[model samples]
Target: MARSTAMKAAGLILALLIFTFFSLAASSSNNQIQILNAERRIDLSSHIVKVFLTLKVENVGTSPASEIFLAFPPSQADQLALVKAQAAIGKKKKKSYVHLDVNPTQLPDAPNGTKYFSISLLNPLSSGETATLEVLYILTHSLEPFPTEISQLESQLVYFRDSALILSPYHIKQQTTFIKTPSTKVESFTRVEPTKFAGRELKYGPYEDRPPYSFSPVIVHLENNSPFAVVEELLREVEISHWGNLQITEHYKLVHAGARHKGVFSRVDYQSRASVKGASSFKHLLASLPPRVHSVYYRDEIGNISSSHLRTDYRKSELEIEPRYPLFGGWKATFVIGYGLPLEDFLFESPDGKRYLNFSFGCPLAQTVVNKLTIKVVLPEGSKDPSAAVPYPVEQHLETKYSYLDVVGRTVLVLEKKNVVPEHITPFQVYYTFKPIFMLAEPLMLASVYFLFFMACVAYLQIDISIRK
Candidate 1:
């Protein structure tokens, strides 16, 4: 009994020592990095909030540092959709930016549950070395509609909340922030010292000697009438065939995520007073599709929608669709768009004799956000060991789908993602192994049915009718 008790005490002491060492190490690493200058640009010209940050960082630590951390408040972190970073190389005019890997990380001692995303440097920065970083991040659902509900004639006004100071884990020597609104009509803004407003731009700070985790809150109220289109759910189905064509169908639950519309909506007033009324509403949406797309169609539960147009060329295809009625705030529309492509364009066989279907992922609509995106790739029957290659992480699972002339059912690869933006529309591949003989299954089945019917008719004719005899 005494021996066991002693062992337990020793284990507790070791665990405490380990925790203390790591805590101190983290503190020391954060203290060794400092910002010489920082410039932040906020673009509020659209409902989506975009922030560009230019940082000049210097390593003051004795040891080499390989990573830099970006800080954001807990409230803003949930709204963040994208984070990207680049490092500037060379001097002045000759400088070029190289993409760097940035990923979210957790800190045990973070105050207020601050979120951190670490940028990995290409080369470690030795003591006294400096580097320049260019970062861009996007946030959705960050703008708050002031009135929440507005009349058709009233213009949209939103409130944007952010900090005038750069949020970082390292101390900053100086920082400045610039905000650009969509229109020159600014209702009000919180002013820090040295704040300036010129036209549609608001400038704040050039503050000096700020400590780590510093924040000075500011709010700006301005006019922005850009379409706030959000897809509540999107289901994309890509069906591949070994014959000659590949088909894609997308179902969407779309909504206008701007200020809610109140009072009775008058079609005549909305049409006649278009210039100054219903500024935040939208009627049309454009989708960018792959080149040489054919047989494109858009329809809803009411059948084919006529207010849409498709333009195609060798370079690209564009489809502009209009909802049955104009989409106002808090309004939703559901529809499906489908098209076909030549099989040669996407399906290819590798040297190892493995077949893969290369296709684009995410919502094809321009400048829209997808709350939940689900992609289903239906591989040809007799497929073995199907896999999906996506650039980012997605929830993946396999399902069986039965279609025409299918015996064992087709393999479907389902990929699910949330909080997707237009930038997520990149190429993904689905690979599987298939035998050529499987392509003949449908034709052979048809042939057998025809032959059996012919034999039955011939036998019936030869037998004749017993009553007539």
Candidate 2:
């Protein structure tokens, strides 16, 4: 009897111990998973402004995971650049691991529980990991709209969602203003949802997750008649020469996103509609270029666009380009523009001893979808350790190249993002190390040729006249 009792007690103790151990393990596991807390701020005091975004991620898991990563929205990524970091998953330390990938064909999307960054834990995480990523960037406007439509002449309005507004560091009470089209009126705005700050966010509504192909319809009727312009794709290139010239080129496809006209355009009706300035479906497209950027030309796969008139003033340069045919609903227009600048206009030596190139240009899109955009910036010959970064939201390092007129064929930085609006055209900067020898080679070569020509001329003059003797 005593032996049996002792055996029963041992069995009960073993069961209790196993249950307790599992409960603790489960609790620990729950605690190890972490989420990212992000805070984004935009300061727009000057034409050039800085965007600072901070991300804090915590891990709550029992066993150590190999890695963790965070993903950013494709649109936001185009305008952001990773500047500094202090990241770690375990006792093992790492300098940086975050990367940006572009899906130009789709809007920015991320799965739940997916981290924007990844971390490798050292001592398999008994607890969780905590990390913070900070990004600093300069924002510039890229989108342009041609205010002509086919059917009804509508007043254009640029809509800035209250959600996209970021706080400024300089002011506590006053926030940065997102200026809308001058003629637009704030008809009726509402905040259906809560925001980080009260009275700031204009919410649309809440939605429940539905199956694929199921779309819940929510219509917002504001003064926003501005043709929903979107350049689904844009390719912008800024080539630098330590040797002394900056060449800028851009290729883009734009589509009309506003309400479409039903039937063929009638010129007589269009002429009469002109009296009522805001009723026609034709949009007058315009692009703003840098004041110093000249020799502006516009063309597409078909050929040169003759209807374009490029004008520059002391303050700014403008390109007024008209399509071969009036752009109706769902119409697409593609064109390329090229211009040049003295290298001295934007390149400067950084305090860190690296040469950096700074330039800004405009990219405009009508209200249509941009499928893909590839931007390639060519660096001059003899450039070493070339690296390029942009301040706009985008996917990065899509491809690298070594091409003509290049010592290293310049670093070709390509950015692809989708569903981009016109107002998002922001300036991007590229920084790299330059070789000084390249700066003088061309000038010296020219001087040597001139000197040799002069010497040869004098010798020929002295020897030729004696044929008579």
TM-score of 2: 0.49
Q: Put down candidate 2 lDDT per residue, 64-156, tens digits, no spaces.
A: 644433333333444432232333233336445444332222112223322243334333433455555454443333222233234444443
The residue pairs that clash in candidate 1, if any, are: none
> How far out, in Å, is residue 190 in model 1?
0.9
Instruction: Locate the minimum summed-lDDT window of 10 residues in model 2.
Output: 167-176
TM-score of each: 0.97, 0.49
Task: Score residue 118 of candidate 2 by CA lDDT.
Answer: 36
